[model samples]
Target: MGLLLSGVLVWQASNAAFVGVTSNANNSWSAGTVNLTNDSGGTPMFHVTQMVPGQSGSRCIEITSASSVPVDVKFYTDVTALPVDDIRPYIDITVEDGTGGTFASCAGFTPSGGTEFTGTLQNLTTTRTTYANGLGPWALDGTPPDKLSFRISWQFHADAPPVAQAGSTPNVAFIWEAQS
Candidate 1:
């Protein structure tokens, strides 16, 4: 009798089951991601500003953690321009840790995924000629190259923190004016 009942059930299809499967398939069709690749280059443009001091070496600027984007330096004339060039009156910074005001903090930055960042280095300043967007003066005693500038710019990502967190904000000095 059990075998007979099983065979009957298999032969009879339920309307509910059919509807569920159809709905799932239709939903999948509406959820496809559009993939496209377009590449171009131009002169990048940006202005610079100063960073406020924070407690114990951290500054007023903060970024979200766990982001995978890589922050790179690019020059531009407009924010919307791809590879913007001819940026005038730039500044470079020389960061000093709390250990005697002589350490360089090359603050790297990246986009915050979809999140909104309050103080983006790109949007902070806008004086094309008199703006602060140049590195001051720097001497490299470490692994990476050193720079100086006119304004204060910090590039941060989810992974690397700025170097001036353990000391004084003044430990990180701004050199100002970088010709790239």
Candidate 2:
């Protein structure tokens, strides 16, 4: 009789309790990226033949960032492989940043804000060596199309020394970098 009563109690308890179950599926994560490009189309910005002292010219190039995260953009010169008779000092460069331009033309380019840089190439190379001290760290949220045009105007100093008369300046490479 006792065994029968215990079995009945166990059955009643098992049937009286309630149960619940829940689960979350497909948990995952991904990382954002920063991508930078320019309008140059793999072409050199300037290619002048026989650039003499006192001669001047300018070119414009637009750079943009297509990044999913915020980023900082900067421009600088790279390892130009200067020869023994490098003529960087006699060349004056004026850098301006604004909007509307391309590597092929500066038609719609407009200058805004202060000049990014205005000095000799030697001074620029020394002062703006790397991204840490480069031309700009344009803090951008990488949205609404982050874009800026840089106009590099150069003038060979009229008073260039005789040593630089026929000497060719080292080939220079302008680089743009965007970092998050």
Candidate 3:
């Protein structure tokens, strides 16, 4: 009996020694973020003074992504104040995707095929449209070079009726938003 007990004990010890061991390794994950900014130096992206009939003006605005992930970009405008004399109808505004331009100049800028928007400033301000979509999968440090430049142009129509009053839109706000 003693001998059998000893053999049993030895077999149990050997089986225990041969057993495999395992431990859990923990891990965690988090989602990235999306951010967009207007690269224009400061306020008043488009500022024109003394606009007259048959006269045109343009301004360049640069946009960049500082996102950690991919994002879609969109544009919006708000007419904070309108001309008191209702001169909006006589003004023609156009937006174009531009390249190789600075905020102060659109020299060497290549227009993206056609105009993105063409209408009176008052009308454009009421609507929010997609200026550029599916922009990029920008990295945290804005990798892949996610950048865009746009040109906003306006002209006082020569054929405008004589009744068009002399007025101005003092404040117009342009906004850029991003989504992942």
Best by lDDT: 2
TM-scores of the models, in the given order? 0.16, 0.83, 0.73
Ranking by lDDT: 2, 3, 1
- Which ten-residue region of model 1 has the weakest summed lDDT? 36-45
Tens digits of per-residue lDDT for model 1 on 71-124?
222222223332222211121212222111111322443322331122433333
In model 1, the Cα lDDT at residue 167 comes to: 20
What's the C-alpha lDDT at position 153 in model 1? Answer: 31
lDDT string for model 2 (33-133, tens) is 89888898988877776878899999999988888899988988865677787778988999999888888889999988889899998888768878888
lDDT per model, in order? 0.26, 0.85, 0.70
Q: In every candidate, how many clashes are there?
A: 56, 0, 0
Better of 1 and 2 by TM-score: 2
For 3-25, candidate 3 gives per-residue lDDT tens digits of 99999999998787566788878
